[model samples]
Target: MTDCIVVGGGLIGMLSARMLHDQGLDVTLLDRQEPGQEASWAGGGILSPLYPWRFPDPVTHLASLTQAAFPSFADELLQETGEDPQWTQNGLLVLDPGQWDVAQAWARRWPDVQLEALDQPAVHGCEPALAEGFDQGVWMPRVAQVRNPRLMRALQHSLVRRGVDIRPRTPVSGFRVRSGRVTGVITEQGELLAERVVVAGGAWTGGLLLSLGAPPIEPVRGQMILFRGPPGLLSRMVLNDDQYIIPRRDGHVLAGSSLERVGFDKSITEAAAQTFREAAARLVPALADLPIEKHWAGLRPGSPQGIPYIGPHPEVEGLFVNAGHYRNGVVMSIGACRLLTDLIMGHAPICDPSPYRIDRADFSVRRSNAN
Candidate 1:
């Protein structure tokens, strides 16, 4: 029998499968489509919380731990899968109207981070493409990024090589519950019996849970755009207001993103596309001349009180959940998976999992109540 059956083959699910496989568990990863082709691929690749100070402690703490894991994780993925998950430490430049006290307040709050105020000339010297006459900006030297899509690919390849049975195009319909404990899952193809089952279905996690008579979760759609530009166009990732611009070493500029509660609608809009282009142009005028390589959207899983729904399900035994990562899914994957793994093994997690537990009151609110 498979020791663990992990549903949802995205970053979180794949990571959970890998960790379990490492512990010598018989693991099988099932997904509706190819793994890592969802929100994990359609992301800005910003490894840091764009506005950490604005978020609560749980989000900040988990994100920080996951951010610290990227450097070494990237190297491990490359060595194991022969895929270079380009981890870039180019930092982030946050620009806003100098008149806004919120931005300045946040800059001051994060003293541990190198938040330097940059003037118009200083910004221009750093990137000639920036719009002139900006009042002030904050430069976070510790901010970093990873090529998210590449990392997902590496994880999938590595998991399979490590003896994980990955089933792409396998949609899980619901779970097999016996006497309040989950026995296995009922997929579109067939039934899978396992000792334990984990749900990492991303945006669709809540619906999947409801089908199993489990609690609810919701999906928030995040739209993004990608542009192809010449190399050296940008030396760092940048954010201003609701927009962010991420550049690749290979001359591709990822401009994003807009958050919408449009309910699982992963379709791009002309207005959103225009908004992104305008925002990118405002940040770096040269982006206006670059050709857009792609425009797409992905549904991000969001939980109530804005914390990730990670850990065991309260009402069910032998079933677990690790979704609702919203925006920071890529950054929070490792730390979140580590906590979940520890919980599954009946061992105490090094970091407190209470903040991200599925049974938390915040997650059990109306937001988590709704399917």
Candidate 2:
């Protein structure tokens, strides 16, 4: 019997499994599709949320913790796997001067986060590729990004080296619960008994939890487009309005994304592609001539008020959750993993887990025995 079974293979699940293994637990990670091919692979890899002030306190807290730990985390991964995840601290430029005041307030609240007000010339100097815009912006010099695909690959490699039972393409059918305690998981192959189970199923987490009378998680589809442009054309991430353009170490630029409520549809619509293209071109005119490299969509796990469920199930013993991260899974993965591991191992939590508790009063998951 495995000591723990993590029932999702995305960033959250994989990180959770790694942490559990580090704690000397017998861990097995099961995924329906290949691990990390879901939202974890599709995100733009921004280390910080687009607008920190706009989110709830819980979101900001987790993001801040992860952002601080990212450099060391990426370095450790690179040293272990010999694969560079390219942790770039090129900064983030918010082109909307209208949000300057709110951004300043948030920065003040967290003195550690560096925020600078910039004039038109400064914005242009920071990113000359940007289209001729009317003046002012905000610069967050402390903001960073990672090459998510590489990061995922490094984590998978490290986990494999650590002897984790990383089971890809293994779909979990249901949970084996007896007297309110989860005894094991029922997968397509067979029953795997475990003392504890964590549902890190991303967008599918809600449905899995709903089977055991938990709150349903909604899938928010985001479509993104990639552009191959001249290398060194853009130095930093540019955010204007609600759209963003992220530059990789190479000449590749990622422009995204359209948040659609259409359930589980990974189809890339022409309209979304056009919207992304227009946004990219508007942000950096040179991108207009650049070749369209790729277009795809991913499902983000959506929950109430943009906060995720990260604690144990209210009613189900031996069950835990680390899902509903929505678009911030990459940003929150490390902190979430640490917190979840602490809870499962009965150690003092790294942060107060009250904000991310599954049984918050405002949001309640419906309980049912019917599968």
Best by TM-score: 2
lDDT per residue (tens digit) for residues 178-266 in model 2: 99999999988999999999999999987786766565578999999899887898999989889999999898999998789999888
Give the per-residue lDDT of model 1 (tens digit) for 1-371: 58999999888999999998887789999999989998888777888777666777787777777888889999999999999989989888877665335655765655555667788777666566678766677777788888888989899889978878999999988889999988999987889999999999999887787744444457788888889989998887888886899989898999888878888788889998899999999889889998998999998887665678778888789999988888888878888898889899877884888877655354455354564
Quote the lDDT for 310 in model 1.
Answer: 78
Evaluate model 2: give its lDDT. 0.89
Candidate 1 global CA lDDT score: 0.82
Q: What is the C-alpha RMSD, rounded to one decimal, of candidate 1?
A: 2.5
Q: Give lDDT per model, in order.
A: 0.82, 0.89
